[model samples]
Target: MAARVRRTTRHSSRFAAGSILIAAATFLPGAESAADAPGLEVPVDYTCRFPSGSHAMTAVITGSIPADGTAGRPVEPRDIALALELPAPAVAELAGLGAGSVSARADLTVVHTLGDETATANWSGLSASAQGITGQEQVTLHAEGSVPTATFGSAGTATLSASDLTLFLSPLQEDGSPTEPAAIEVECGLTDGSDGTLATVVVAEAEGEGEGEGAEAEPEKPVENGGTAEPEEAAPGAPRIEGRLPAGAREKLEAARQDVEALADGPDPCPFPPIPLPTPADTYVAGYTNVEKMDGAALLGPAHLNVTLMKEYIPDPCTSTFKVLSEAEFEYGGRRQLPPAQGTFLTYGFMPTTATMELIQVGGPAQIESVSVTSDPAMPEYTTVTAEFDLRIRDVEVNGVPLDVGAGCHTVKPIKQTLHAFGTGNPPSGYTVNRGGSMDGETYIPAFTGCGADEDVSSLLTSSISGGGNYIKITQAPLCVLNDTASVDCPAKKPTPER
Candidate 1:
């Protein structure tokens, strides 16, 4: 049997760079950015485990991908390849085993980041042709193949970085027969503290969309009344809407929308076929609700939410709603994984069954808009939050009979709600953003649309479930500090309805 053992150490091993090498690149000052250059050149260090021992290898990856692409369009990278230089010691050992030639196949993982949203994809099926091995001279393996394409859903600057490379080596005799060891699998990880950036691309809005028409409009000066000033007329050359957006609010709104959308994806983690346990989060914010319908049936939920705090841009001028703070300057973005809720309720006093509802946030994350602090005992200290969402009734069952609601069954308009929280203990029972507490709001459910897959059931649902005066009671749990074990419950508990 072949002696089986593995060892690892840091060593200055070199790699023959190629278009698709598994490595990070070095960028020189004054050089063209990846967007302007013909291709990217990056150097990466990796630690690989072999039967004899572990070796550290440095490699340079060179490849070409379009510097700019339209949102919702796929961008393909070209001339992707990999080159590896095996140390002479490892080559000699392979030759000693009666193997005359060797070949390899590799796969790599790539990460794409747009704002705070991140997605990972794999680049697989690259191969290096077999080459003869002799004496103690170093051996070189070259690999190249088709790579996956990346598609961005929104407009922004997206960065693509590479990590985690796996290689499969096959040893064979001169006649191409497998050697005694057959094949070897080597797992390699980027060296600690090494960057594996592949490329950065700028994504623009799709065709026929007017996204940057009035880029020069500045926000109106703050007013003494604390309300937003009436918007002035647009400059002669700018597109005229009802009003112009603040100087940079358009850009901020785009980014905020992308960030909120990232968090709003996927099913709710609180119910049915339990989800994986939560990971340690540095911060946590949740919304638990018991929403009562017009007919008294209720929906219970705790939509777990997280946000990226301390962002520097305000995202309101693009909205039709009036601004609360005449001089609001910053905004925070929520993280992805917004939960879709599932619950069962009694309909019309007798029918009992389950329903799957998707709460789609209409615009973006809740906006704080403004905050006020006061030393005078009578002048209250408070902050207001505004958010809008469409309650989509996707699946329903009455008396265990599945209602054929079409995919688009949802409220005709988004349900707009405003919430308030006291920063100080003014009410002693009110919510504080940082500490979490109770919040209540009322929603007007408009008629449902696009209901009924086989037969039109839109009227049936609208008449029985839709109306004004739907009450929503929510309780937010304290922020979970992921790093502080004492302060957080990893994978937060399912929220309990407040009232």
Candidate 2:
């Protein structure tokens, strides 16, 4: 959330966790949300509290959404738009930090100086960034995708979850010198679930050698002040700049990754039925692509190969609308004639399903609000989309053991899915700023009675991906596989970040 600021006095001194300057702030609902507002309109108002009183904070969002995903059209490139300004005095003081830049290094080591004494800390392995702070009225900061001024456009609330968010500031350093990096970097986390939004404000010296001394910097948890100074109160739902994610985030993700993989390449073969892509009526993100590939399954002892692909159109912001281009590129080959069971598809190729996702960031963390199976009678492609699992199953004997998989062999229960399970963006893709999710429908085997839970077929799917700014980075990625098109490779594990 907020950086643990250590408030120091006008006279510089060795800095501790809680020995930095303090500022108080608050927010008041200035106006009601324009529920009837036809098109997307963003309104931001916040003030940073100082020692005396509150200052006015305001920002403006200007951009257009296109209509690329309207019908069955192609995607186009888009960019985020935002403008913000800090108080004039803060701007002036920051400007006074003579000749230095604001910087956040990959592995940063700094020697804090307050008059004479100093301490060192190593902020390494992790990355952070911030931008848009030059003594000016407003600065341009692009936030790849679009955000909702009102929740689902009806709740009459705001998510403020712009694909990329920037905080303007005139950061200062000791001795009135600018920090080395010179810019504020911005990074957001979809893995944070509802409140995944975080920022690391880098406003200190990049490298400092104690006066007339030479020594290495070591990591240490600077002690806090004896609860003397207090931070300013934040607006009702202001996004916090948490330096790092919560503990066990990696562990939870690893567990999800292992489980999904088993389900994908398990006995059930296909856990995620082919779901319909979103249409123009849906909320659209700038650049989106999802690929899930699996192999090895013996349904009736016939070897099969399956791959599912999902993609969203990219277009200029103004006219663009949310829409998905989906395909079930599953291939079931081999002439080994296997006995067919009831309710099982003879090459059932994608039994049919559809998905709807919402990206949100308000009242909580920035995250994928909801991902549910939906149906559209007007479009028969996704008639089977539902939160309840209905993955088509079959009745047969595996290894000479008879198993029950529903009458028609269709799965119907709670479909299991995991978001941010593999970290950053979707697993396999692991695209930074891009959110990822997967579904592994549970398999049911008759427990000598009726259909009982067996195991799940892991699914490699990305229900949603947001924020790439103007530049789009497609890893050794794949496109939707259609008829006559060959399927692309989807790694069983998350890919390393593209250097």
- In candidate 2 the C-alpha lDDT for residue 89 amounts to 56
Q: What lDDT is reached at residue 181 by model 1? A: 70
- Per-candidate local distance difference test: 0.54, 0.25
lDDT of 1 by residue, 1-499 (tens): 1111111110011111111111111221222223444866777788888777888875566678778876655566766777777767668768877888887767777767665445555565466777788554778787776555555555678888878887777777777666777667778899999898888888787677666432343344354433234235434222111101112223433444454345346443222232233332322233433333423334344455553322322322222111123111112235232356566655664566567776666676666543322332322234456777777887787777888798888888887766544433322223444445545556677788888899888888787777766655555654554556443232233333333
Instruction: Evaluate residue 293 in candidate 1 and report its C-alpha lDDT on the 0 to 100 scale.
Output: 44
Model 1, position 221, has a per-residue lDDT of 39
lDDT of 2 by residue, 76-173 (tens): 11222444444555444445554222222122222222222222222222212233345454333232222211101011111122222223222335
Per-residue error (Å), model 2, residue 201: 35
In model 1, which runs have C-alpha deviations exceeding 4 angstroms?
1-37, 210-499
The C-alpha TM-scores of every prediction are: 0.36, 0.23
